[model samples]
Target chain A: MKLEGKRLIWQEYQKEIADDHYFYARSCIRQTFFPGAEAVFVKIMKDELGKDIHDEQHHTSCTGIGYHADVVPFDTTMTVIARQFALMTEAGYENYAASCVTSFGLYTEVLETWHHFPEKEAQVREFLYKATGREFNKPKNLAHASDIVYKFRHQIAAKAKYKLIDKNTGEPLKVVEHIGCHYSKMFPHKGIGGAEYPYVLSGMIEAWGGEVIDYPERRHCCGFGFRQYIVQANRGFSLSCSKKKFDSMEPYQPDMIITNCPGCPMFLDRWQYALSEMEGKTYGKNNNGIPVFTYEEVAGMIMGYDPWKIGLQLHQVSAEPLLDKIGIPYDPLSKFKGKNGEDLGIPETPNYLKFYAD
Target chain B: MQKHIVVIGAGPAGLESSANLSNLGFRVTLVEKEEVTGGHLNKWHALFPSLASGKHTIEAIVKGLNPGIKIQTATKVTGIEAVNDYFTVSGHNGWQEKADAVVLTTGFQLFDSHRKEEYGYGIYENVITSADLEKQFASGKEFVNRQGKKPERVGFVHCVGSRDEKVNNLHCSKVCCITAVKQAIEVKQMIPEADVFCFYMDLRMFGRHYEELYKQAQEKYNIQFIRGRLSESTEDKDGNIIVKVEDTLLGKPLRIKVGLLVLMAGMEFPPATKALTNMLGLKNVSDGFIQPLDEVLHSNLTEIPGVFIAGTCSGPKSVSDTMADARSAALAVAEYLK
Candidate 1:
């Protein structure tokens, strides 16, 4: 494969991300699955970078999941998105940065719909005013949180306590970046690297000193098709999708997988354990499953944040192997510790995959 | 005084037109941009349907050209201006000729396979275009993958850069369908044990004997013709290409791994032809090929009085069709000169 050709494509997919002052919209799935990702992102923006990012408690879900599952009406979803815009306007911020790829995709779709059909925008305005008595102005800029991270990757790398390099081998870690399909599939121009070869997560991986693996199934879905995963019987199809990715990437023997999408990391992480249980096959080396991480958690880890503090311990596959390879010191006993220094108790361990619970 | 004519592009069309015009006793000057006369014909290994040698074909066409006709190689026409009654054609190499009429047979360029990112043409080592495969065949080396292993399976993806709105080309590139079939058959002949598959949206066997070649591919060569468009291709660890395409007939998705994947890139108007059109203020059809005075009646004549277009520059055409169009254009020029 020609790296120069892919570099040319990556150059074309660069999108405009605002430098500062963002109205942050959190993901419902990210907060539920990997709770620390959004928290670390907010902390990195405000405490680390000293950027003004308002995370409003009043803002609610964009109903992306319900809308994609065909349960929520389009009009209702548009109004909900309009309400989020109302909160952004109310907070006096114009740059809307979404933590979830699905919300970002929904926002892009709604904005495009309004751009094409002004009448729909006017109708949504009436619906929002009638439902919540709120006024809104569309955000001047819409960027995914990973876009912001990608924008600040170099700066974050400069302040890093460790690089995504194996200290033992002195080589850049082979990292596979799985982008959320919704991040760019619906609208290629909206994402950092467009649809075919998205660079949102890979940009972060490259800046943090890792080799990005362009695996065969790199563009495949993470098996979290909103409708497919929501339905009980169709769950197997979702598992198969993730399994396909695992089967394809296994040959490369990547050190870890990093993802920008909320469900992608969760599915790519959890499904490794599930696939091991069902098929007795593991993708990682020496009976260890490949570690999956959100971009935020990866950034936070490289930037010297405590692994336990950033909720890396909550992962199904243990991150200890990667930490040891990178020579990052961690306290294994504090894996289940809470914010107030209390033990949250350990979870059950899988038979095939390695898990740390003490 | 004998009337002089300038023929641009020394491909099949230009060669045929120059020969016909020269035989009719006109002073013909053939301008070729390449060091050699034949355009894409020089690069081709074999012709379709008959699988005749492209070298022999070009030799036959070149043999027809009279010694009286001046053949200027390595001459690229930079500008053509119509004077009061005649025209002056100037080339980049400082060669210029005054002629009573000008014939444009600039031909067509192969679609750049790199434009289709999903196919992984440039990024993948084993994924190549139809033109690239022809070069390999012409090289006389054993058909092998980048690793020099005999490819166990080969795939031919049809209609790339043609009839696809994503790339902004909607017209059917009239020759790629048969080219894929022909190349697939060649691949089978090269590796008799290799599994050859052709993924196509439609099998347009519109030409004579083209349907027979397609049928022979199915019955004799055992080539699998899957009715589908390839969605994307990815490279395996061994440098093989894994293609994902849906079998539209079976209503199912298929993932096939091939040692080599050949993308049947279609034809498009070369930039030189477009520049000529712009220079002459010639009308172009919606598909961007130079428009003729009339499709059926005056296809050889453009709106300009002394300017005529033939071959794929007017539109995508097979070698036979281009040769016929060149002859028709020669007749039109002869009639106008009379």
Candidate 2:
């Protein structure tokens, strides 16, 4: 009953499983925007967690985002899920997960619907079987990388031999965690815990010996609204969403922010910059802009894993100063090297490095 | 000392700005033209992507307020003025107040779809706007055509009263594309046998799970999408509406007959904006959106020192964006007063 010292739920799963032979479901955005998140998941799953995840190219994207847009039909969602399952199963892999919350939800929903409605399931299975000549069974669970990091949080903290000490306050950090809409809001009951308090990313932040700040707009959507920023190009909407979280946490003055979804990070980071441009007054004197990270990158930081492997450098909003403030000795210029050993101006120290001392 | 801050409009933006300012230790008064709060959200059952209960979002915002925030429903802002650093706001029934700062979170009205006669919105029995559909769902009425039969086919026309040079609305109503997608999905949920189609210039799933929702509607619900604006709608003998559109993607003219047609309407600044702007000496964009002091910075900030703007009052925005904008506006007020 007591959650104080106990490891979070997902932390237990990572320790129990040695092999990470995961079927990584692809995201359409990942193919375009943040491939680094997938890279981080793969690197951690292989080198640290000691798992072999299959990155088989034959498995097409889940096609759930398009379906949610009403551009794709329900039959296509079923077909996509079926085909994804067949590819995973045919490759002799069972455990499957997606970096996208929408994909995870879609795969889970279609599988559940198929199992509950035998007739619908039969039709889909027959169609898939006829097409691929393979029997497809849904994975035991379709997960986000954040869900996994949260599951194995204790191990991550235990393996973390390095800690970040704050230079100014000489104290650990009080953090704010922003989870995306897909992780909880889209299907409130589908994930591990209730949407209001999805302990996945927050659990990881806490396990790392940092405080999690609860802001007023904690549960609101990031307002990426798909192409609203592009089609109509309303910077106000995107900036406003970021402003809500920033304002809520301003009183707390969190050292940095942690996000679970890619979309959340994109909006939170880009909008912060946009807000700064639009307002002329920076959030927190331009220094108050919270550095955000995906759950895997957070775990990697806690575990003292390779920063490059975690893809921390690819972040739009630089995390360098937070790393220095946290007392993590990162070579600002030496780190985040290009293929030819050129620095990408990425900070060596993670924002939370100083908050928790090993 | 309680500093009076008057907020005009009881919509999500106005309500949120009032509630947040009130919480930050200011005496706030919110005026609404409607008898109820929640602005547009009250009319809908759920929001996009997340499909969060609209009632809950409105309630959550309301719950954050303290007694200091006075919400006056069925009230209108008649005039506003700035004398030096302070502002005087006036309304009906001798309602008058002075505020150290004023926030114009006055929300937007839906553009009248009937103006686009080609769509046959008011003339056709089967054609309706997104707001009309939302009103029907809120009233617990099932979606049925004039004949009272469960409609087998539904067509959604996007960009009605928005993004048309002819109407002088060059700005895209950012919410229409996603709202169309959300409503299409909702229709599929209500009537699984119904074939829903969206006529749009482009499917903008630019948000998180927006693309996913679009995909879900397509892959899960089998909705059809045509990249075109409906040219016109005509009734057949059976009363089914026939829509004529040039499929932009297909580069050909096409005619589609459907039982019901839903138009995705745009946003317009309420008529009160001009009166308020004139009285308060607050500046607005040419299109009547309350122009922020700086588009890049002070987006929620007004030039009149204490006046702030949030939500679609500044520009057209989705519900999620409006709430976030409201929070920022709240922060702007908090910092200014403090």
Candidate 3:
């Protein structure tokens, strides 16, 4: 399928993305659920590309989950984001790179609010200064890490050891790219290709030699509806939401599902597993379940980084077939085994995100 | 000297305006880009609410065309410049005309449903446009499924390409909501077994007798209305379209699988209209339709003294409204020639 409205031109996709010296703010959900993926992102920025990405210890969370979960008030969340800006200014960086889609969306929301109501911005500044004698400078450009990776996809591809093509058939793998709702929904112009056909992940899929699949549910939210999934009684709403996406994409038989959001990847993978146990149906080839990955994980693999170190084994659905399909050599015994091939017995995980050593 | 007026399109507006202006004893030249000239009205299977044949309506309008009016077919207008006393219009194929006044009735092109990629118009097999549905109805295919079986459910999604910030179009396509209501009734009449649903952000029943049709759709046809914009559409393994929408009325997210999904694509500024606008230096409102000199007082007059706009090229309108507006534009031209 065609990429639709989004062409390969970088500027037409999104306004601007900074290349260096960025103040990186981690996502609460991204760090907790996919910790290794975040670490891999930092590794790629520092070791692989030698870019300066400051993930300072004192940089507070954007509290996007707390805000969306309705646990935190608007003032509290704005203050926390303001505090993060203070941390960035203290570190002398003007570019803000968010690790999570929710945080990126929140950042955009607050920025757009400030644009619409400069008085609200002044209030935020006063609130920040009054809360902690901290003076801050607004970031010049705000970008999601996924957006950065998308901007640099071709640069990384030129150094990649392999394309995202199925090795057996020698054809580009059919990849379905799911953009997080927050990345583009709130303010489309701030997003890649203005939300209609977001080019963020799709551009990377194209750049890395993968055939992008277009399904009707391509733009639907992962249904993480943070509050919906957080409350035990409302989990059905979230599950049914992803069920719609899975049911839609199943007909196309994509080789893998890739998302730019942490919660989306976590939910998409978990829900597919949940759907199988609940409905007695599976979507992946050979009944292994389709592999879902963050753009960071896939980018790392294509960069020829060690998959185990990047925590590919931590996924609920095994990425084993994907690794094998791409002909990336992974020792099955070492999957549960440690780096030194020692038995570090894994702790018991939940039934939904069931892990290795179970 | 004969009072001459040049009309830019030979669609209903041009035909009606040419006929009306010629009746007032003014010489008229009707220019059309296509080899034949019913414009968009020529393609429709039937009109809304009444299910009357659009062909018959267009044929009558063409029959009413004054024999004194000259018809220029398959001609492309490149520019129109207002000379000292009259307007000089130039076109390809060495065609030229001069008139005391000009009327732009370029009409409009239906919004490209493909632009809203989430709806899966071109990508999904089961999804078709409202215009396509009319043609399907015209062909006497009451129920259309690839398997030739009656569909279990049919969905009509309003505003596929209108009033959406995502596509850079913010004006409501005036007739779509009522059109959806009318089409839903037709679907129910065709397949009595099928459940019909209309998903819309808001239903605008502004036209006369339109609200009655909507009431009939609800009371008589038993068509369901969901008050929310359909977020996206996806297909199941069996080629059934699964639509996801937030039922704002009930404050719940809903998904339904339907065998046929109709996207009510809206109207857009046609290239022909834009070409005319640029060539004649006509000003367009923020929504991109040619702006009238005064939206209320001088709805037919353009900023360029004697240039007038008519029909859907001015904005979204129903056929009846367009015909009324075209006649008013004819009067404005007639008044200008005086």
Candidate 4:
């Protein structure tokens, strides 16, 4: 990306987007915390869009968390990636789309290394062949699944029950797009937009008729400094990073935040919850916290999917107010209580966003 | 006829070369795209350490220009082509000139702060690049936020677009460090109530008295120096910029909010240099700046005979360095013509 004194002409940035035959790689954190996001993504691809997407049983974790957390060695991490590639070869898909930003970055980094150092490539290839006799070729295109969604954003908007705008005010809902650091910072050339001014998430927000907030700290790391969060004492460093973003963006009065990374949405969501507990201060109006959604969950929301099925309720911060803002109707009782079970009416837990009365 | 020479750009280097070559009995045409000369020197309020006025310095250089030299204002050189020993330079308005020799003092532009979008320069009103801050100083205007109130704290962030492989700019901009230090002091001088901080990966005060100014920023001016690159900057409720950075020296992340944030934008090759090189068949080094015949001893000469390079157009340089380079280029042109 050639920048003339930091000006980004909206039409100049070009990125490659493959239309079909995607081999999806899921994130461990996403599966553990927000499992329904990938499920909803797969559902959209299969039922809604009629695209062939693989959510294979054999495709395991990318081991990026372990590698970043510093427990797994670099060689072991490369072998795991080789094994994942072998699975893709068997699946016969040539496009590699990663659900996690870290995984996408790792894939980009390892591929770049392979491009530069053939010996390292030979080593990983040999290890894969010896372990499972599974031979694989590199994918024709490597991309984050969010990039694919961004590419087809206009199509998704066309099929939508609603535009991401405030119904009453007739204003486009103010949305902040948080790009994961690993998504572009490590390998800018590989990402949808180059590292400095990535337009991947913002493009989707714009396409869906949402006002993408260009807040001061828009490109900040989500504070998923891997070891910073994994290590107990260093967690302050992790949380402080998010606070910095929050303090910068609070003035914008953002209705929602959308992220391309698995860990970032979780961090942004949970940190708001944690901040309220620790400081007794809330950001959103009337103490209703701003909703944080992964790009996949948002794609599902805009497509009018059931909120529960998309796993938004799993978030610590509430998405209830945002649902109300976008004019999406849901049974209030079902938000706090379970299905076909007793109306264990909201007496036990205090509803965070006050979707249920105290 | 006396040897006719063309000097592209109107910065210190271009002006110095024109004056020196004209004094050497060459009829020089100094081409400037702007109505005025001085380039970046006009933008700065003062230089570092000594705190000398930038305007007066440029005036002194302008005063030295030989009267015989012809000045062309608001004229851009579109292309340069070698025909035999003479080069034909053409640009907008059907403007064309033939030169026995051409000296490209095209000069460098500041690194784009928007490339480091994490700093929130264009997006946030309180967040601006060093060049923007210098404009505020040069104008002597009261520093104000987006809401037109005096800022309480101002931050100076170094290495906005330099020393980062993400933007494909790995070379140090060479002057931004000391420039930040100078600006921090100036900010403190004007707004004594406002706290100032410098966030940097490394303080490259590799010039004379630059380290002293760094020390003075801490000791005399009370400007805080943190040894870390800023991670990101965000704006608060009142348009205050909030920054997060790992205090690498402290081994922990530090978050601070300031009323104003200034990114120490680095230097990069000017776009005009790219066009000029294409027109003149010049090659740039790997770092994107124009390449000399050889970096060490033949820094003034380009691959084509009678074609010379000067100032930050070749690479990052200080005002004094640019002038010296321009003078050396003048000497080289005189020898080439002889």
Candidate 5:
């Protein structure tokens, strides 16, 4: 049997795996914005991996963003975290996966703090026990979705049926990956596969025959400068963060930019259009900007799964040219293959990328 | 000819003033020294009182802006002179603008935490500024030290830069007390096992929500708020930080060891402001805030005609106050220009 992308990732990075059961703790960002990534992950776990994944709707948002903003009190955030952990423990799962990097970072921080501060932990635990009527400790594994994907890289690679051969060059493509802050900077030590330069996303990109480009602002924050977004009321802050990446990437000109976290992807993708408006410059003649893909979407695409099935069509930034560069033109006018190989036509172009060249 | 209004500082105050003036049918030009426009708020993850994320505040004001206002970022105002009734401002880029009115919204800069050597901010890896914590929080990380270890105990040193007679900064920074309280509570919330302590000279719960927030940190979060200033901090080889200070509340000198130490550095005007004040002939108060003829009556109006001041450039202020000042300055400039 040929090596699949997910399998390749696993072979390179998997430390331990109890794959039968997974506790899927959904992210607030995922539910609010990147629902497609959630749907795709669920589908992958259920259909392909044949794993029993638990996603409790009762689990409220991590509220990390709000808590960090200093808007929501610490006690309120603790209640939410405790309730979510209780829900997971009640479901008979010790392992949990976060869709957003921020959630993972917060969960880990809260848990470590709770474990270290026994008196406070007891108070919180007792309070949660009274409120939810459930005994709970911190989760054993607060894994990001990329963690599992990277763990099972080989399996994912072997599953690829459709190869993304470049039409112009007749070779595998070149790519760049932007790891979100929630994943890398927040906890640099426990990152996926613990590679100094974790090859999780880049490894998969290479498996699909694309080279990962390291740009200047690779480690720079997206300057979503969330506070700046509101208090100062200037669009320039956002533009500057996006421009750093754009200007850096302009010289290298990678075919596409891949990211793991939803927030990073949203800013990078949406800001491209905003940048165009600010600079009065178009990226390409057809104005097709850099396409963004999540680690799962990229892995699934390499696995030869239909684009729509893996939520590729839902991206605000078009991945159409990316598909073309890989020797497969994702015909927007034409239908895409569904799970059962049924036809689902290409999605409507987002307003950000409404104008596209032929 | 369109009456051009030039606004100094691209921070919240500057942006707000420009936007407000532009809305009233004035051609407004806003300048910022940095490449970005949000000011210090951009670096902060959350603010006290409502603990609102900086995003919501930034977006709300930004969304309410007049798009017609021309925003010039990465440009500094080098010289400003009143030519008759109009003000001419020059920039390093050789860019010059003649404004019918000016609003000096130049916000406060963070006091160099390192300058207070007793705090050990830059010297110790574990010793970080409140600004550093804000960035971590904004980046979505929980309150863990640079060592990747969850701190068992954390100490917050208040009034590190503010209210220091030695630094010639005698005025009480209105926000530091509440800010220290808020951070202590957050640390406790993140790590219930972690003991959190705030060493401060006085707990200034002056604002509307300020008192409530301080109480919540004490009553609800169980954070220990000590009314004492930190004397000095030292890091052991273990990297665990030890703080020596008089617990003024207890009136006894005590040593507390903690895994992390955060400095609540106060706000100040940058040195560049002195040059701007001299060149423009704008009167500055003893404490360096731009002085209006009557602060209460003409808070935004400067001594010179056609020039106004807003935000911390005038005096130390909270975010909410600075924003209000920004708008008031805008109205004053707009009314004058009209």
Candidate 6:
């Protein structure tokens, strides 16, 4: 209710992000689920903004999923992260930008652990040097890819071909920004606006001419707890967690949900369909489900990138509703087309949830 | 010559100390930074255990002060200097006093509720602190939520900033538990039909009559005491606060929607007191409260001979304990001046 008071808290949680020359670390889940998101991010950074972002093929996963699932040991995860740092050092980049919120959190945790215990850093250095025969200097700056987008939000807004404002109603889109718990829950100072009210995605939403909706469950986890979803029986816990968020945000009737985490957008989007199928309950208007998009996808869409090219069609909840509201143009035929214009085949429609093809 | 004693702060501690010092044939000066005396007591509606009016209590304490005792309001102590056997205390208003002894009754300040962001203190319209609730009670206005409607259900969260390692404050605030119980009873008295709930980790009713009041709160008022620390709070569209707390007794997570949620913010040493103690080269404990020479035997005596600490400046204490501490400090100063 008091926007001024929340602004005071947001001002206290600002973090420094490097301007250029970032060594990009790709996420496993993001690349697997929303491949076009990272592609659009790289395209926007290189072609549109002319920023230097080096994405090395040799860089491996940070093993955040396995580590969080309790399958991988802590020491192994540390050395795996050390290997990523080694690759960044070989590429001669000091600023490390992660494509995943989980990776960003893991990197922050490892760095903080190293800062607190130099012996652990020494042991990890030995592990990396012995295994990969590589030396690494710690990154000068650590930032999530969304932090980079937030830092240049004004510039993106200036170059945006279309705003997030509805073309017909002229009202700003009501956007729900669900931040990942790991993004700042462990270390609040590492994130853009602290853990409670992160401003990374909201900052971009504001600059892009969208009204950020402060729902009751704005800070709830997306229910993508690795172990919870990894195990079969515990998957209900995850689904119910996302359901709780949906139930809480239902009153707000947000236009769409935007997220920085790789799992959040996927879970928030997929769970809408799951909930609709399970209980015949739909949160959005007209039996439609709430659309969820990664921050990169939203940025690319506002920048006039084709919706198919940005992979909005891949979402379980149709982005057509949001695209129509924003008046972004997209050919209906290209909804299921492959990169080379081959027919990728349309998926089957659900009973309750609205699908574009249906 | 009668030695002049300067009592910094004009709260109950300072008032009692000045009264006792003046009664012992010493010239006393009571300095308060605020335009009015009574400190936090002025904002409070009633005291705990007995539910006495805070205004009347302060009036009785003020009446006990001899007319010879100089009362200086709105005088902030800028610096204190020890020259030979006498001390010179200078105020921010350019007033000065020479004293044989200085009693530091500079009390504790309430913990800032904003630091616990998960509770949504500042962000949520329905989430307020205990002090804010006290001010509402003292205002004699009808208790209402942000929507200006009488709250159906009110919740009190205990030990907001005390004994919480996340905020780096581990010491118990000692007074918040009783204060929450007192305020909960007051809320019931004001709104008899409204449901009142108290969520606490563990109720520390260590003081005399405090346990009886806590028992009375449950037996008489029907206040629901859930043994759980509040995890977080969110505000609904209707300005009601949805609080998530585990009912430890049931070993299950519980969610309750309350029309108003009150956080029992704890006490910590005020920054002014810290600066004054540091300037005077007095020792402070790890928790940042002024250090007593011996907490058991010589609690009023500081390492510095002429500097004595009273009330919550040394630690968190109830108003009754602060008054007793002030009298003990006055006795210690009298013994030191001998």
Compare the candidates by TM-score and give the number of the best one: 6
Tens-place lDDT per residue, model 1, A1-358, is 8887788888887888999999999988788899889999999999999999998888899999999998999999999999999999999999999999999999999999999999999999999999889999999999999999999999999989999999988999999999898899999989998888888888898899999998899888899987668898899999999998998898898999999988999999999999989988888877789999999999999988999889899898889999999988899888888978898888887988877665
**Which model, 1 or 5, shows the larger lDDT?**
1
- Local lDDT at B144 for model 3: 72
User: Could you give candidate 4's per-residue lDDT for residues B292-324 as a string of tens digits?
Assistant: 999998999999999999899889988878889
| lDDT, candidate 1, B191-285, per-residue tens | 99999999999999999999999999999999999999999999888888999999999999999999999999998888767877888889877
Expressed as tens digits, the lDDT of each residue in A51-71 for candidate 4 is: 988876787778888888888
lDDT of 3: 0.84
| Clashes, model 6 | 0
Q: How many residue pairs clash in each candidate at the backbone level? A: 1, 57, 0, 1, 49, 0
TM-scores of the models, in the order given:
0.96, 0.48, 0.82, 0.82, 0.49, 0.98
Poorest 10 consecutive residues of model 5 chain B by lDDT? B114-123
Local distance difference test, per candidate? 0.92, 0.73, 0.84, 0.83, 0.74, 0.92
Candidate whose DockQ is highest: 6
Question: lDDT per residue, candidate 5, A54-144, as tens digits?
Answer: 8777888888788766788877788788888888888989888888777877777777677788776778787887887877757777778
In model 2, where do residues sit more than 4 Å from their true spots?
A1-358
| Weakest ten-residue segment in model 4 chain A by summed lDDT | A1-10
Q: Give candidate 6 misplaced runs (Cα > 4 Å).
A: none
